[model samples]
Target: MAEVEEVLSHPLNNTDEAIKGTVKLVATPVGTALAYGSLVFMALLPIFYGALRSVRCAKSKNSSDMPETITSRDAARFPLIASCTLFGLYLFFKIFSQEYINLLLSMYFFLLGILALSHTLSPAMNRFFPVNFPNKQYQLLFTQDTGETKEEIVNYEFDTKDMVCLAFSSVVGVWYLLKKHWIANNLFGLAFALNGVELLHLNNVSTGCILLGGLFIYDVFWVFGTNVMVTVAKSFEAPIKLVFPQDLLEHGLEANNFAMLGLGDIVIPGIFIALLLRFDISLKKNTHTYFYTSFFAYIFGLALTIFVMHTFKHAQPALLYLVPACIGFPLLIALVKGEIAEMFRYEESPKEVSGDSNQEKKESEKKEN
Candidate 1:
């Protein structure tokens, strides 16, 4: 037995092959049945819903009243449906394959499964807590349906329903993270959630630091890049209204400045927000809830990026970097006012004058009596 063990551990040509065989044998039965089963389900369920919704849309042709809930535009559906369907089929093949089952199949399916599961729950999370809610003090900055005045969107009200949904999603992610014995996906999920919370808490942050640098990447590449592409491709494929000089692309400092090349994308928007609130008191418009949610999300992600960079000595003190964020917070708030009101349906807030109407009705009833 000792001789055989020594032979196996030797640095012979066949030793590498022997070790690989051993590793595979050890890994085969390690994966739990439940993990594979969930992967199969997640992959299939989205495809099913997407297909069914598409069919329903087809059957109800030209019926604007029965619009698709999953997506407003028809072009958006194909990619989403196709991706989920393909992912599901991939998992199924992995689960059933005899030779490839436990090797490449097991590892790849697990990763795909987490991505699908996250997508399945993200929309409901955005809706309930609504990362953005218009505050009364700043309501005048933009006109909500109620015509209230506010400086920035206030999130004083907490939705228990949303809290419950978030809690459930957290629990699900945590459970999967632990059961799957994976660190990367777990960390990514946690980071995503933290970004959501940071978005909710942003106010009066500045710009022009590593954090801002981080935010540019987070927004332009991670968040805005995908969203802009999808928006243009699907919903707003309309022709660009040509306006020269106003929208001209120049070269040099004329073409690119501190605002254009670096933090300007975020800073410029922030400045516009500040100007809108300062100059255009009559600018009464709102954006979608997603606009605000994602707005702060990018801001917070920038903060995190700065903090992490500082930790590695790639940047200066965290506070110094945050000056830009501190300054930009108000600007972002102003920029998002119109969108926020439309999103929360500020037009739907219960009327305060109704109590006076009720009192008048009571007096009329007394006279009748």
Candidate 2:
């Protein structure tokens, strides 16, 4: 899921607003199609790759690899938090100079984006490390003692390959900071989206529904009901959204006509799709029916968002289209297959598992007695 501090960007009009107060570049029909096509492709890559990685992370014995599961409470409160932050930024932009606000935001995201990119690239970078390389392990530990009780504050483990990934990520981060290049921004945005999907787990289908449903209203209200979302999106200078130039054909690499999509749009729906993948794994079936169904539904939803935005020439809440397709498609399948009950019963949180284990142990003890 996206960080609560960042607002979701709408599909089409945010880009126009983003480049406002500057020279606006016009894009032809072919250029516009290409831009939209690239946006779709970019959005698909992270969700597919991240969903697979999330399954691996769930199965991994390493505690560090374990995903952070979202509960019903967290899902319910997400929209309220996001709306507060969105409006807060809108007010900040109104009170201060956009340049100064973005300067601070750019620096903050610079540090955050580097760490996210490094984490996202670590697995792939590890594969490329030469066999002869000395990949020494390192640990960073912090603890505090209170009346003979010690509490662990931070415990992190890494190796030389991880450092190498960080170094490479830092280079990209510097590039983004110095130039604010579209490609550099995209690099960080992709990293953020992939990591969010891989690390954030929805505990069950119901929680996923609550989250997407809440955000559906949030996105719609922000985009259609008021100008707060558009204002903040245009003013905020960060890699929280992925962007593609619409005039790449005419202007080549220097194209300024861009189209944007929020990482929230990708990451929020992405974690839900990932949860479906994990649910499929639990079924012990040879096929990934739910995963693929939700995946294609996401594609259709996003494509519909783009189509509607293009036809109407207006900004659209991506979640409005995405929520129904993502939730409905897999649900329809479950209903048809008579597995709706089983689908809702599946829970993967550590707390839930421990509770179940305790109950089973008590039941067994009573039987033995």
Candidate 3:
């Protein structure tokens, strides 16, 4: 396999320790399964959540807080482009970073993620923060194409609950900064995973497939054909990947050897699954055949990835198995039901997804009045 020339230098390129951690975990079947299960849960939970929220919003009067789906063919390319760029950037930084800037960058993201991921905790947190409390708004000025500039405001209110979450998460970052604890590493990892699933949107099945196909090849070449993926994965110390303690039950906490899964493996397949869920909601007939089928297929595919890695004692590209399973099962179901054409025709419109049809009409009436 071809290896990336280590063009830069970093202390985390401690290849000896990384190989030690990853190599022996294969022998522990229970640990391997446990780690894979935790990863799968984190990955799919947000997709399931967003999809459920999408269905609920479709039935409701307002969904302004819900995410809007993209409709333009050009717009759909953004996520794929962003993913590729980020992947390359991560590899570059991983091979360098003498000052450990990635952790600092991760700290900023973790702060934002704590707020975004804790929305479910908001209702209870509201007892402390309250809705009527003063809100803080930050503004950014953007220059438009027509020699005009517009200011956009983002509203956020920091309260007791937000403070506590932020303080505790900051403490975790500090711990990571000083000691490089797995606890802090995993916390940021989970938060980033949850944030991506919550915020990112894939426009449609066609867009999802395009992204997945490109990434599928990317993953295979890096993982199997080249040594770059494994080399970077071993060396990069950031939380771009999830790490779960494998020997917690047997060897206790001291056995810090972990089973790892990269975020790319999770997020790439997840967006496609979310698209399928929305497609099910759009059917408007209360059937979830495609959605549920794809969900379980994900479990099966992840299981196969782990099984093969353990059996062959090789680092496997998860998307090789995952893309086919996630995309294929749902397509097969649609084919069987003779809804393949309808499935292909399905698209998510922002107005429809956000339940904004009535809201737009109300705004128009105010203008006319």
Clashing pairs in 3: none
The TM-score, computed over Cα atoms with residue i paired to residue i, of candidate 1 is: 0.21
Candidate 1 clash figure, as a count: 28
Candidates' C-alpha lDDT? 0.29, 0.84, 0.61
**Model 3, stretches more than 4 Å misplaced?**
1-30, 54-99, 119-179, 351-369
Please provide, for model 1 over 11-118, each residue's C-alpha lDDT reduced to its tens digit, 9 standing for 90 to 100.
Answer: 111233422223221112212222223322322232223322322332332212122121123223333443344344445544565444334533443444343334
**C-alpha RMSD by candidate, in order:** 24.0, 5.2, 6.3
What TM-score does each of the candidates earn? 0.21, 0.90, 0.74
Q: Is candidate 1 or candidate 2 better by TM-score?
A: 2
Displacement of the residue 296 alpha carbon in candidate 3, Å = 0.6
Task: Indicate the TM-score of model 3.
Answer: 0.74
Indicate which candidate wins on TM-score.
2
